[model samples]
Target: MARQLDEQIAGRFQVGQRLRVLDVGMGQGTQALRLARAGHTVTGVEQDTTMIAAARRDLAAEPEGIRDRVRIILSDGRDTGVHFLPGSFDVVLCHGVLMYVADPDPLLAGLARMLAPGGLLSLLVRNGDALAMRPGLSGDWAGALAAFDSNSYRNRLGLDARADRLDTLTATLAAIAAPLHAWYGVRVFTDLAPDGAEPPADLDALLAAEDRAGRTDPYRGVAALLHLCGVRD
Candidate 1:
């Protein structure tokens, strides 16, 4: 996911452009710190106190130069308006967050509002259209059947979450004046891999195959996650 986002950013902006970045639901500040290290000014907003503390700890460990580029805030993603002015950021990231939101439209609109014209909105979401693939591949007949009828499922963390269909999100983005620009499937072949599973001996080769499938046709359609990039108009 990080690699993909880096590619997108590189494609849209020049190196050392010093973009303003807002990472919503930035757990542990992984992406936030990475962008800051790359010369972007990043602000990480996280509601979880433990996650905020962990992110701060990680930030503190960085050299002063890198650490100075990042700021961590404690707030829900929906409250972006409270913390920032409209069009404050050049890049808005809401990765791995929408599934927990019961009503994602309002939150998405708020995020869009934070983007300057032509700013990028990067979203990582669970794929509703492919929800049945996991259960069916795992031999869970009942779960697979249930998935075919609904977008809600129990995630690996045992939390009830909802997935999003690409079409629905595309339309929503258009309505918000941030049309979808590009999208790629994530974890196309490794969605069923067991937790903590180590990479195979040919890790590079495996990743190459996964990367190809993520951008290909039928395979991408059934991927576990979707990485959607929208551009604010």
Candidate 2:
């Protein structure tokens, strides 16, 4: 996951270029800190005050030089005002956030609006289509079928939380005139492991194999989620 993140961030940056980066739903500012350290100016938009405070404290704890390159704003992405100009950023990152939203179209539109011409948008969405692939692959046919047919894997706030698929997300991006490049499966193997259970050597190899499988056709359909990137036209 970290390797994939580094690659995605690197795509939007050139060394020594004073670029602007926006990390919407910037939980803890992990990506923001990375871009800032690479010499890009970063603006993180997050609505949760507690999360904002923690991010602020984290920036304070960083070495003085890195902290100065980043700024955090307490605002939702949809409403960040003239504080940020359109076409101001080189990259816009939205990760693991669409899952909580009932309708992602608005957020998608908002990100598209913020993206500069030829600028990149990197998105990580929960792979709804893979919800049942694991249990099915693990030989639990009943549980697998249930997850496959259900709208949600688990109930949230007495409601179902729908998962997303690469096709649906790609369509959303296309609506914004942003075409996607090759996408890869993220967390394809590690997520299904028993928590805190270290894998044996053979199992490690198997996990790596599955990760590769999750990147290919047929197998990719069952991955935990997908990551995609491209630029607005």
Candidate 3:
């Protein structure tokens, strides 16, 4: 996903351009710090105090140069309008957040508004259309059957969550004037991997295979997660 984002940034902007990045729900400030290291000015918005503490601890370890590139805000994604103006960012990231929101469309629209012309809006979401794939392959026929008609499910954390279909999201982005630029499947063949499990010795090869399938046809459609990027008009 990092490589994909860098590709978009490189293709959309000139060399060494310092970008203004807004990272919504930036857990532990991982992506925010990474972007700052890459020379972008990043502002991370997170509502969780624990997460903010963790991010701050991590930030404290970096040199002053890197620390100066980041700003941590104690607010959720919905507060963007109150914190910044329209077209305030060259990139807006909303990853692993839509599932938790009861009303995601308006939230998405707000995120799109923060992007400048031709700026990137990156989203990571559960694939609603492929919700049945996991249970089906696991031989849970009843669960699979139930999932076929529903876009809501309980995540591993035991929280009720919603998912978005690609078609629906595509139309929404179009209406928002930030049409889909490129999308890729994530966790296609790796969804079943156990949490905190060690990587296999063939980690690179496995990732290569996953990356190839993510960009290819049919296989990508059944992936567990979808990575969608939209460009502001």
At residue 204, what lDDT does model 2 achieve? 62
Task: Report lDDT (Cα) of residue 202, candidate 2.
Answer: 97
Tens-digit lDDT string for candidate 3 (149-169) = 999988887899999999999
- Give the number of the best model, judged by lDDT: 1
Clashes in candidate 1: how many? 0
lDDT of 1 at 213: 88
Q: What is the C-alpha lDDT of each candidate?
A: 0.94, 0.76, 0.93
Q: Which stretches of candidate 2 lie over 4 Å from their true place?
A: 9-13, 81-83, 134-143, 155-160, 194-219
On the 0 to 100 scale, the lDDT of residue 84 in model 1 is 97
Mark the regions of model 3 whose C-alpha exceeds 4 Å error after superposition. Answer: none
User: Between which residue pairs do clashes occur in model 1?
Assistant: none
TM-score of every prediction relative to native: 0.97, 0.81, 0.97
TM-score of candidate 2 to 2 decimals: 0.81
> lDDT: which is higher, 2 or 3?
3
Say which candidate scores most in TM-score.
3
Clashing pairs in 2: none
Q: What would the per-residue lDDT of candidate 2 be over residues 83-136, giving only the tens digit for each residue?
A: 776778778888877777888888787787787888878887778888887677
